[model samples]
Target: MSKVRAFTILEMLINLTIMSIIMGLIYFAYASFVKQVINYQVSIDEQNELTTSYVQLRTDFFNAERIVKSYKGFKVIPYNNKEIEYKITDKYLIRRQVHMLDTLSINKLTISSDFNIITKEDLITKMIVETTLFDEPIEFVIAKDYAPNLKLKL
Candidate 1:
């Protein structure tokens, strides 16, 4: 009689080993995809926070008459003769101002500046401001300045 054909023990072991390896590879790939997706979501959240901060800062700065000073943790800008001081506290940007209508008492308002960027320019001067989302230090730069109609010398 012809010998019956069947999978030998060695063949079965090899097939099982191959399947385990394939499954491991698939699991690793899926895990990597999940990690990347999480990272992407975090990045998007950070970007949205930054954008919101920037817009609010821009609106406030442009409406003000002038910028008094901007330092690492504090900024003072003038609206008319009165000035608004924005101080960076542990949790929020605290704005202190003497109320225009009532000069005797100081008014305070608090808001978050999770991430912010401010830029200013005129014929004479250019300035930039930036603040990070996660307690990173603020940064400021003076880019360029040209007196009224003076041309920049290469």
Candidate 2:
């Protein structure tokens, strides 16, 4: 009789089982890696958004002619016979500057804040504003060189 060259039924079954196990393991690993990458990307995006928002807020505060106490969830600044109000509302940092003889409508800016408090230690001959992002509770520290010397409650 001629020698058999094909795999036996038992050998084929074992080979198929081994291949299935290997494929399952590979799929599991791939899924795990994908999840990790997504999580990391989300974290990075959040951090970048927080940084950008904080910088914009800091810049506004630094350029303001005054920084008054918090009123109605806002800080008022008097500039050129007009009032500029900075406040946190609905998970946004809004600035409403009312110019003389202008409509009472307020302008809106995209920003947010957290439960962060400003400390004197973070000031360098200027006022330091610290806050957190709306989506995140983590605090952000911001400093500006121009201090308006507006009296405010710590």
Candidate 3:
């Protein structure tokens, strides 16, 4: 006679339990990875916004015909007849035009802001801008490129 052997009920149960534990561990690892990715994306978006705002400001200040301090913020006059203004109100840095009511503003992440202007001469000016984000401070300075008395021209 020949003899045969087969798996017992207890052995099958043990195998299933081991598989379930491995799957649980994999699920935990995946969840943690997803959370970290989300956090990194948020930080990237914030930096992008700050860079955009700073670059736009530099362009405006560099090409401005004149910059003046106003009650709201700054009145930047360009070569054209149109007037563009930057204002700080309601905890936001706002950009708007003189004849229009439409406004564009910094996102809610910005907590504080300041604008300063110095008329170096009739055709030259110096400007400094400071703003706070996520409890961190950032600053920018711009010197107008046009002047006549000192032979510096547009």
Highest lDDT against the true fold, candidate: 3
Give the whole-model CA lDDT for all candidates, comma-separated.
Answer: 0.49, 0.51, 0.63
- Rank order by TM-score, top first? 3, 2, 1
Model 2 Cα RMSD, 1 decimal? 10.3
Return whichever of 1 and 2 wins on TM-score: 2
**Cα-based TM-score, every candidate:** 0.47, 0.56, 0.64
**Which sections of candidate 1 miss by over 4 Å?**
64-87, 90-129, 133-154
Pairs of residues at least 3 apart in sequence or in different chains that clash in candidate 3: none
Off by over 4 Å in 3: 1-9, 97-128, 132-135, 143-146, 149-154
TM-score, prediction 2: 0.56
lDDT of 3 by residue, 1-154 (tens): 8877888899999999999999999999999999999988887877777677778767777767666566657777887856777776755677776565433334332222223224332332565556555547766666665445323322
Candidate 1 colliding pairs: none
How many clashes does the backbone of model 1 have? Answer: 0
* Per-residue C-alpha lDDT of model 1 across residues 26-50, encoded as one tens digit per residue: 9999999999999888878776765
